[model samples]
Target chain A: MTEFIPPATRWHTLPSPFAMKRGGELRDARMAYETWGTLNAARDNAVLIVTGLSPDAHAASNEGNPEPGWWDAMVGPGKPIDTDRWFVICVNSLGSCKGSTGPASVNPATGTRYGLAFPELSVEDGANAAFEVVKSLGVDTLACLVGNSMGGMVALAYLLLHPDSARAHINISGSARALPFSIAIRSLQREAIRLDPNWNHGDYDDDTQYPEAGMRMARKLGVITYRSALEWDGRFGRVRLDSDRREDEEPFGLEFEVESYLEGHARRFVRHFDPNCYLYLSRSMDWFDLAEYGDGDVEAGLRRIRVDRALAIGVKTDILFPLQQQEEVADGLRAAGADTEFLPLPSPQGHDAFLVDIARFGPAVRNFLSSL
Target chain B: MTEFIPPATRWHTLPSPFAMKRGGELRDARMAYETWGTLNAARDNAVLIVTGLSPDAHAASNEGNPEPGWWDAMVGPGKPIDTDRWFVICVNSLGSCKGSTGPASVNPATGTRYGLAFPELSVEDGANAAFEVVKSLGVDTLACLVGNSMGGMVALAYLLLHPDSARAHINISGSARALPFSIAIRSLQREAIRLDPNWNHGDYDDDTQYPEAGMRMARKLGVITYRSALEWDGRFGRVRLDSDRREDEEPFGLEFEVESYLEGHARRFVRHFDPNCYLYLSRSMDWFDLAEYGDGDVEAGLRRIRVDRALAIGVKTDILFPLQQQEEVADGLRAAGADTEFLPLPSPQGHDAFLVDIARFGPAVRNFLSSL
Candidate 1:
């Protein structure tokens, strides 16, 4: 086993100008983020890893666990991201429960949680916040900016907005625009949260229940699309989780392993996630559209990207972010004369494949990083 | 347009035995059905068209309108089913509100709708009910049995239970086994109904609201899987139904065409379908397993089928009942030494493609019936 050392980190609040997607005057905003690796003398060895819907700036490794961050296995000293050689930065996205300025964050005016009063955040706003976070770190340009899922959309948005901020980009399991099915699924999830009596119109600070039931239901729905049917069948199937039978027991019960898996997912999500933040982030993801900035021409918007290299990775079984979608991103980058590589990861894990099957995804990412 | 005439139709009640899947058994069950066309002197012109979830015995062209039934375009006088020569019958399925013994039907013992107390039904029970309906028609054997979706499962179950009953079977957009994702989806839908405050433990009378919100939510969830992402994007890519927008309106609101489609479906379904019956029928579809009755050997179960011919139709864009699933059905029939034909219909309507694009499906089905 390799000996690991937890990195000493410092948090900073960067000023972020809130940009609206539907068209309006930009608003003043700020973001909270952290840096793990050291910036080089030339400030060119920077790698920015943007976060997903919920996670914060602690992407690679954190202080308490000593086991690295959520993507620690893929981003560490001599790891795929190679923290020893390059400086890595992660940001807690906008409209998240993390230290980022979100629904849970205190409003400057009211000194209370922004809650429902928080302005709707778009993916471009997240990208803008990330850009501010990088600027606060005194980095003029980035060697590579990596993001996954909604984070990937943020990275793409970063490229579209800044144009000359990053040399390379890695978009993993994300789409150029939110598909109709995705919008529909997210809408239902938002409805689930909205319908919860305890949600209190997003002002449930006094309610201890905090819309847990609705959040749990939303999480259950999320899990269904997060993983593929084949994976669920192979792992869970119709096998019963428990065989204990009692008198007067309900005859028709959940006798399937998949049900248990989904239940566990719901339980954990309800425990950790804030319903308001989930709603805001999901809406941010649904409203993500790079082409909207360029008058609906996706290719034209991509052509504005001045990145030297781009990497697009998609899971074959990912119905949500599908291989075809990643190909579109790669094609767009290629059309812009950027050196683009499209990697299709074969796995039955679907949208979760990027997070779960590291053995297959890690090596490909490492190879790509090394090449960069 | 061809001039059409209404046919004199006769209705009958057939005894349907109910065997609960979870535990308890229901005896002396009965099913209601209707028949059209004529039986030959040798009693060999029988053709069964199993109706889908919630539909009653009305499957073909009725008297008032000249147009055929739900499948009337393919089941009329000179249509695919050839009413002139074959005896056609459509049964209102068990656990449905279409003149059949369902949750809404009065229990002879209690003199009230079975409600939550209704015994859990399986596809086997549905097939048994259809068997009684067919037998009551005075036909010892059937020339062919045709079905779609849930009805298709019933047809397959009939083949599994009574191997020598039908000479041919046509299963449209059906699966050999319920997919795990489908099971998960159904489970969530059931949970939605059970969670609804107005559900009143499934005892809401016909005059009551009947958990409309829960039913609508369930339909919304169900509709997502019924169609493909491609179709959704093509039809409704974030186009708002309401043109006027206020400052406080939701950003990127249900502007997509697909949203309207889903809304229409949910409204229509909630108006026509019973919440408890939907739960029961969905459960029946989920619990359907041909191999379970044949000692866990699916191939062995298929080998036991004594059908002379089989035809399987799958929709290209159907994510719920994918083409691969239909192929599995066809493969099983072929393994049973039954002459089989598999046709994959290309349409954007997804699982509902068979119902929506009747013109194409009608011709294909008509040709197949002519050949038979």
Candidate 2:
């Protein structure tokens, strides 16, 4: 059996809400988080790196068998985030399969896994959970809150809900509101999970076979949007899969390097991710809306923010979160009397540029953090 | 039933070798073509507009229903092609269902549909067929041969096979070789058709099902690549299919504009196209490679071309056939001593720009044809 090392961190419990926006209620809610570096006497050097849809507190730190964190390149000792300079904190939000109290967590009332009984999590609720994590960390104010994709949504929510909580915010490859096309793609991914016969209506236990097929399908669909078409074509136009073909046989097959890349991504993702979590998180992303909380006046809502600075970074080829959306975020922040910087990075990686195009992104982020 | 009207002019058949590279023999193969406008006494006023993968002889002249032809904008009485001065001919190439001997055509010996017995066609075969059509039109030489996508591949083939056939050639949004990603996508589409329960190993003629599910899936996949993510996100993001929902109950969900758009496209295509035909055409496209025929010397093959001039047009957002491919075509033609013009049309519609972005494409094509 593999040895399990408990996280060298503390967990924080949040006030239970009866019902969430999408229905269902929580009896006892909690969040998992980890902190790095040290808090200054004024507690002003805190930097919160919010986790994506399924990520946990181990965002900027190493985990299991000396493997580096997802954002290690941007966060480590002398890197962009610079753990040596700032007290970096990451939290596992509600409705996640990590150490947080999610569908996989045991329910106090039922004495069983919450499963589908877990309350649906909105971006605001996720932010609220993170807020509790921050308070527990003994931090009164944060220097910056940096997030990517769904985490960006959470960061935006934090800026809206607790204006004085952070001095700066970085929203990377995220939008103010989910677009209709995104909703459609997310819906399909959710349906792929829900429709899987092996899902057993989300009742499968840890020991049971997970919805691998559904997860694989969802990952495949996600991969399509995560990269640019030019990247796909340039990397792998109509190429043969196998070189040895029987005489008189048609050799036309998925021979392209892009197809193999996409397939590998799907296969690897399915191995670690839960199908139910995929559906829940995708739906939450689709429903995320900053204007909704601000009564539909996006500018007015942003004006209510009390942050000191904002940084919006967009990838040029990211169709999911276009550069225009980032410009809107910067415009909103500037209008709110907050100093804002909008950087559009050129990359062929599309929406996943933040994760893959480290060469270009690392220095920009480092400069931004240093300026802050 | 749809009304069928014969062309005002008579058709002449030109002889071609029926034997394909795949070892199948199509005995007594002939190419049928229609010519519009009068040929000059010297017969040097000939122009050829190669139709797309499925289009037939009716490329640009008015037809029975008084509908302008497929390329009516650039080839009318007083338009760019100038029917008053130049003779234009369009042919139905081999391995197509448009008045051509495709899988659906009856075999002379068996008195039945050729079906899977149809020979696997190559880009060279398509060019050879076009050569026959040009010869049958009684044109000793062509002033120009214009083609798009698959048709562009044929034009390249023509340049390699019959170096002195045309003075100029236009290859729009096409590549000298099929990219690996394109082949993989085509393979998946073919697999969708082949795996359908109703496919009956490509022999389900009597079954009325006609692989609708498989075809619908294939079309959905095709539509995703046919357009760009930017276009889809800008047009359809996450809009719901239904605006009204019953109280206290979730309505049958059909959310997201992209899904609805793809579904509509899939449904409409299924009504007209055969699943088997889709498979055959996709495979043909996947296998197309000018380098394979020119002994893998693309530059040398292009240098052998005797065309006096060439025009290559590429759409900015055409991921399937990007602007770089068109640039390569122009460079090749220029290297061969042909006066070449490379025009990159700006559009967000991706590969479908040629069909939809008429405002931009029309003027460019008009200018080129007028100059010719």
Candidate 3:
């Protein structure tokens, strides 16, 4: 409905007539980012952190924003990234609504929300935007590039497009291309949003006309896939909600705890995220294919990227960006002559494990950074 | 939507004021069924079939209906559960709209569609209705009972509530109770239907007011889960739809072949099945747990079922009613002193494997019936 910018977020302006990957251009577009710790005099100690969809640049609390961030546990001082030792820069993706120039941003020419008029966004576009931000920071090279989920795709695009930008890479639960299953899931989610009468071809206002129901359904479907069924079975089982929690008048209302959990999780998310921005980012993922860089060969595309070392981490239980994709990334990096390690953790949390299961992910990341 | 009855379907009126499982009663309600082969003088060469959520009574083509049925591959003369030897009967579940008295059927008192006025249905009620049909056919004891997906749950209820009504049981891709993951999927499907403005609290007419969009979404969701990701990966891969197949005008429209597949599948299903009936039956599934019969022990409740022999078959890739649930059924049947077999097939099709992979399922059913 509207942009949601974190207080800690800072901005970096891009060159005028910022070109988009697929076509069209945005004028006076800016990238949103937040940094933790100081940049070393050499500038080589800076690590760029790219984010998954739905996260702002606030990876951890800072002086400007004391609130905890989505990845606070994995990026703070004495943490996996260890901001005390390395300055970490996290940027909101280009097509996102988190203070980044996106569909929610006012059009420079029309002075209205870009909405459907926004250019078809691509992961490569986000990667290029982040590269601009990194260039503006006067960082010729970085210690490591970190990316999780959709961010992993962006990072890959970054490395492929800009050579030797980072010494090493850490990819968490990402894929080389969009698989059929993931495409279907994302397609259905977009359909849910568009099918909503309130969505109104991306013209709905933030108030009564917002597509709350569509957004709720889309988020619920996402939450269902983000975690493993094993976790749901163990945590909620067949537990029914209390009578007070139940909607008694409606026959097919909230009958189970899992349903209620999804309802609450979705309700909190719908208003905070712009529907148009979500559609763009999600469609971008479906369109991402490393093969485009390799003339219809994904492996050949991976071979084009050069890095000193790479580590691909994934959870065994993740059904969306599964463990095999992690192995693919590791193998591809190895083919590119980069010393690579693929770590498949046995976390039951699925695709979101890297964000929450810090105990398992922390050490691997720390050891890799220490080696760097 | 109006009830869709095949010409071959025959009806058996339940006793007036027939009681329901959770409460309430149906007046002059009827069960729809189709049968083949002749009953022997002994009246023991009979096999009864209960079905999944969508299918009607026409499980296989017969003299009265030459049209192929849903399980046409597995249930004809000289086939699995061969009608040449054992008289075969398939009944549409009580709450279904396929020639069965359900929400789509007329309420005798008001002479209008029952809609939400229909009482809450359960697996046990379906079981009882099928049992009534079997008794009315003068079968003292069924030679065997075959159930697939939701039917498996109904068959188990039949055996538990009416001991010795069936001598043997075949439970295919079914669970003793509703798992949290399954419940969440069904809950979302119901929500999609109810959230549609055209659904009109189940009062919408079948003409212009039909909740087509809601039903399409629900069916698409169902189709996504019915098969495995492994199958999707192998079948569709990341193939894009042809330019002609793509809905180019809509930004978030169909792009991938998988999305097109889902669209066609959902479009074919939405109008055929009644929205209210889908809601009632889906919620019934979420409410199905054998633990109710054992004071909160699903295993103990499953143990209450008694039969001469039992076969529980499931596919390795079935995420909905997973392989573990089939094992649970076998374990419980064995605990109840029935000679039980658990067969987990390596079908790529997942939960719907039983309906399509007849080459594998056929021999198993045939051998099990040969033993009976």
Off by over 4 Å in 1: A1-10, A16-30, A64-68, A206-209, A245-252, B1-11, B16-29, B64-69, B207-209, B245-253
Candidate 1 at A206: error in angstroms?
Answer: 5.1
Task: Identify the runs in model 3 with alpha carbons over 4 angstroms from their true place.
Answer: none
Extract clashing residue pairs from model 1.
A60-A69, A61-A69, B60-B69, B61-B68, B61-B69, B69-B72, B236-B257, B239-B255, B239-B256, B240-B255
RMSD of each: 4.7, 4.9, 1.1
Worst 10 residues of 2 chain B by lDDT: B245-254
**Error of model 3, residue B131, in angstroms:** 0.7
Tens digits of lDDT, candidate 2, B1-372: 011223542344435346676577776555556677888889898988776665566766564324566666767687766788778887776676555566666767798777777778777777877787778667778988878887888888887888689887878787676765456556556655664567666676644757765666667666776777667666765445564531114221345556667768877876466555556667777677766655776666666677887888998877667678788888888998998999987788887777677788777777777787
Q: Sorted by TM-score, highest first, which candidate order results?
A: 3, 1, 2
Q: Pick the candidate with the highest TM-score.
A: 3
Candidate number of the best lDDT: 3
* lDDT for each residue of candidate 1 in A1-372, tens digit (9 for 90 to 100): 011113333445544345555443233445556566689899999999887776656666545335456786787788788888888887777667666667776677776767777776788877877888888788889989998988888899998888689998899998788878888888787777776677778877644657876786788889998898778768876565666532125433465677767888887777576777788789887767667766787677777777888899999888787788789899989998999999998888999787778888888778877887
Per-residue lDDT over A1-372 for candidate 2, one digit per residue giving the tens place of the 0 to 100 score? 011122654578777753566666676777777777788888889999887676667766643324566676887678888888999988876677666776677789988877666667688778877887898888888999988888888888888888699998888987777875566557556645554556777876553667655565567667776777666666665443454422235323344455566667876776466555556677778778777766886666667777788889999887666778788878888888988899999888888899889998898888888998
Q: Write the per-residue lDDT of candidate 3 for residues B1-372, one digit (tens) a residue.
A: 778999998999998899998999999999999999989999999999999999999998999999999999888889987889989999999999999899999999999989999999999999998999999999979999999999999998999999889889999999899988888888888888988899999999987899988888899989988998889989998888899988899778888999999999998898799999999899888888999998999989988888989999999989899899999999999998999999999999999999888889999999999987
Please provide, for model 3 over A158-184, each residue's C-alpha lDDT reduced to its tens digit, 9 standing for 90 to 100: 999999899999999998888988888
Clashing pairs in 3: none
Per model, how many backbone clashes are there?
10, 17, 0
Predictions' DockQ, in order: 0.51, 0.29, 0.82
Worst 10 residues of 3 chain B by lDDT: B245-254
